[model samples]
Target: MDFPQRKIIHVDMDAFYASVEQHDHPELRGKPVCVGGGKYGVVAAASYEARKFGIRSAMPGKLALEKCPELIVIKPRFQRYKEISQQIRQIFHEYTDLVEPLSLDEAYLDVTENKKGIESANQIAREIRETIFEETGLTASAGISVNKFLAKVASDYNKPNGQKTIHPIQILEFMEELPIEKFYGIGKVTANKMHQMHIFKGSDLKKKSLEELVRIFGKSGNYYYHVVRGIHRSEVKPHRIQKSVGVEETYWENLLDEESVFKQLKLISEDLEERLRRKEIRGKSLTLKIKYRDFSVYTRSKTQEMYYENLEDFYKTAKKLWELRPFDKPVRLLGLSLSNLNTQEKKQVSVQLKIPFPELD
Candidate 1:
C-alpha cells in the first residue's frame, strides 16, 4: 500500500525565552543573557550569546555565572511569553488548523491542504517566519519536510532565524548523512548505547535489520527502524488536550533525607500550582515519582473527590504519598504530577468491543 505524502512544517523559536527577554530589553541584545531562576536557581533558558560560554537550559545559575562573569540573569515572565505564543499560534491558524504545539516556543503544522491554497510548503514557511518577525518582533526557524520527525530535524540545521526544506526526493540522502545523536528522542544515554553497539550514524542504524533492532531496543526498535527509513506516521493534532500537569527536579547532589525531599516537593508543588493557574486547570489525582541514584524508579498516587488547585493542597497530598513510600536509598530525581484533569470539555464515550458472531452462537 502507498501512503499519501504530507507537508509538515516545524517552527522553533530560536532561544525562545532568552530571545523574548532581548526583544523586550534592547540593551540585552548582543549580550549574554539567561532568563529563568535567579542566582543559585535553575536556568530555564539561555540566549545564543550566553550559549557561547557553554550555558544551557537546566544548568544551575551559579555555575552559569562562573562560566561567564558578565552574564545577566533575569527571572522568567511566563505570562508575557504565553501572550506572544498565542499571537504566533493565531498566524499558524490562518494557514492551517493542524497545528500541534510542543511548547510555548515551538509547534508542528501540517499544511498538506492549507486554507491559503499555497502549493509550496517552503514558501509558506518563509512567509510564516517573516510574518512572525514583523508582528512579534521575534524571529523563528522553520523546517519543512514530509513528516514531523524530519521537519523537526531540518529546522535545527540552521539556527537563529533560518529555514530548511527536506524535499521528498532528498529524504533518503538526508537521513543517511544525519548523525545518530541528531534524531528526535535519541538522548545522551541512548546515543552512548548506540555508540557502544557501533551505530553512530543514520546509515549505521539503517543497516540493522528490523528483527535485530527489536531484539536490541525492544518496542522502541520498531520506531527507530521506521524513522531511519524516513517514515513517521504521526499526525499534527490541533487542540490536543493535556491529561496531566507536573514538575520534576534532578538534584546535583543526592537528596538523602525526608526533610530535603519535602523541601523539593514544596518547590515542585508551587511550580505546578503556577502552571495550573496559567492553564486554568485542576486535577483530582496526584502522583509522586522518585528516581534513585541507581536509576531505579518508583511511583505513588492518591485520588481525591475534590479538585486540587492550590500549592498547599498539592503539597499535602503529595507529601502523604511520599511519606508512604520506602526511601532507604538516596534519591536523584523527584517529581509530582496531577492527572484526572478537568478541562471542561464535553466528554463522550465510544464502544470498545463488539461480537459479530453473537447471533450465530
Candidate 2:
C-alpha cells in the first residue's frame, strides 16, 4: 500500500499577546490597547483597536502614544503569557510528536499518521481548536493542507476564532488568487518590487519566466517562482538547536554615556529572557552590537563553557562588551544576541521517521 501523503495544520492565535492582556484585564476589553513599556519603552503588543489607529508592535511607545493618546499601555507580564503558552503547547502535543512551534502563539503540526488517525487534516484541526478553547478559555484559528506553506496561508484565511482548509484539489485556484503580501517570506519591500514588475497576484507571477525573475530578484525570485506554481516546501522545524536569539533597540535620543548603553542592555535582557524561558533554550555565548551616531557599527562577542540562565550573567557580559569597545561617538542603537545554542532542552526532542524524497524538478 502507498504511504499516505503528509498532512499539516497551522495554528495562529489572534492578537495573542494583546488578547491575553485584554482577557485578564476585563476593564480594558473592547478598548484600544497597546502593550509596551511606559513613555520610554517600546511597544510589546498592540490590540486590534490600537492597530486601526496605525499603531503596531515594536513601534516606539512615544509614537504609539501620539497615534492614539487614549491607547492603554500595559507593561509586559511575560511570566503569565509563558504560562498560557505552556497551556497551548500541551494541547498540540496531544495530537502528534511532530508539532513545530513557530512562536508562543503559533505552531505547525504534522499529523500524516496521528493519534486520531483522521483521514482529513481539516477534521484534526477542528478538534484541536475545540480542545484548546475548552481547556484554555481562549480561541485560535487553524489552516489545514498537504504542505507547510499552504497550511500557514490557510490558517490566516479566517482570523479571531475561525478555520480554513485547502484540499489538494483546490490548491491551484487558491494559488491563482493568493495575494503577494500573503506569501510567506514576502515583505513590504518585496511586495513593492513585485508590483513594479506587474505581479499583483499569483497569476501575474506566473507570467514571468523563472530566468527573468531570477535575474532581477536573485535567490528569492527562484523561490517565488515555486510559490507561484503552488509548489513550495517550507519545512516545519521544531525547537532544533536554535543557532541564535537576540534583541535590538533603537534609542529615541543618541546616547553619550556608558550608563545609557547598559540600561538598554538591561531592557533587552529582560525582554529576551522571557522568550528564552518560553522556548526553554539557553545560551553559552553572548553577542553585543553597537551602532554609532554616524551609522558606523561594531559587534563583540564572548562565550563561557557553561550556559547562562540569570540576568546578572547576561548584564555582566554586555557591560564588559561596552567597556571593551570604547566608542568615541554617541550610540544610536544597542542589541544583544545569544548564540552557539544547543542547550539542554534541545536534547529531549524526538527524531521522526524521515519521509521519502519529493519529485521536485
Candidate 3:
C-alpha cells in the first residue's frame, strides 16, 4: 500500500520544567536543580547537571538527594509553565496550524502544506528551535522526518538543543539500527518482553511475521509490525479532543489515617478544580484512583446527571467515594480525574496529496 508523503516535525523542549526554573532564576543556571518538593516528594524534573548524577523525574526525592546532595529542589510553578507554553505554541502557529501538542513541553507538527509554504521540513524545524530560544530563552530540540513516528524518535536523538532529520531514503537503515526500547510507543515492560523473545532491536522486531506479532501482543502487535517497517499511518491531529483530565501525586510518606487521606484528597481536588476552571471544562463523571502501600491500585467512579466543574462538587463526591473504598491500607498515591468531558470535536479538514521531499546531505 502506498501513502501520500507527509512532512512531520516533533519539537521537544529541553529539560522543560528545570530549564524554566533556571531561566527565571539566573543564579541557578550552572547548578544541579530539580522542580519538586524536598525529602518527602518526588523529583518532577531534573536538570542536565542533576542528571549527571543519575537523578531523573519520578525518582523519590530521598534517593535523588542520596545521589546528589547539592541538588537544588524548587516547587513547580504550573501557571508560569503554562504561560511560557502558550508563547511557544504561538510561534508554532506562525509556521503551521497543523500542530498536535503531546504536552506543554512537546508537540508534533505537520508542515506538509505549512502556512509559510516551506518545502524543507528540516529548515522549518531549525527556524522553530531558534525562534523558541530567542523568544522564551529556552532551548528546544527537533526532529524532521516523513512521518510522526520517525520524527518523534529523531527529536530525541539530539538532546538539550539540537535537531536531527530522518530523510525518507535513510528510513530503513535508521530503523534497523534503532533499539526496540527507543521506539516511541514501546514501554519498558514491552521492551523487556521483546528482549525475552530475542527481539532486541527494530531489525529483530521486523523479522516477526504479522500473524506472530498479533498473536503475541494483540492489537498493539499490529502497530509494532507496521511501525518497524517504516510504515506509521497515524496523522498529526491539530485539534485532538481530550477525553479526560486528571491530576495525581505519589506522596513521600504514606497516608496512614482517614484524616490524612481526606486531607490529601482535598488538596488534589483543589488542584483539579483550578485546572478545570482554567480550561473552562466540565465533565459528567468523576473517578477516584487509590494506590495502597502495597502498590495495589483501585478506582471508584461516580456519574452525575448534570455536568459539574467546581472544587466543592468534586471534593464532596470524592470524599463520599473514599468513605466507601475497599481495604483501609496506608495510601501511597491518590488521584482524581474527570472523564466524559463536555468537549465537542471540531470538523477536520484532510489533505491527501503526495509531497516532494528534500535530498539528504
Best by TM-score: 3
Q: What is the lDDT of residue 201 in candidate 3?
A: 91
Task: Give the Å error, residue 228, model 3.
Answer: 1.4
Candidate 3, residues 69-128: lDDT per residue as tens digits?
A: 999989888779989998999999999888877778988889999898888999999999
Query: How much is 196 displaced in model 3, in angstroms?
Result: 2.5
lDDT of 1 by residue, 94-162 (tens): 999888777888988999999999999999999999999999899999999998888999999999899
Question: Local distance difference test, per candidate?
Answer: 0.85, 0.78, 0.85
lDDT of 2 at 100: 81
Count of backbone clashes for each model?
0, 0, 0
Candidate with better lDDT, 2 vs 3: 3
**For model 1, what is the C-alpha lDDT against the true structure?**
0.85
TM-scores of all candidate predictions against the true structure: 0.78, 0.78, 0.85
Model 3, 233: alpha-carbon shift in Å? 0.7
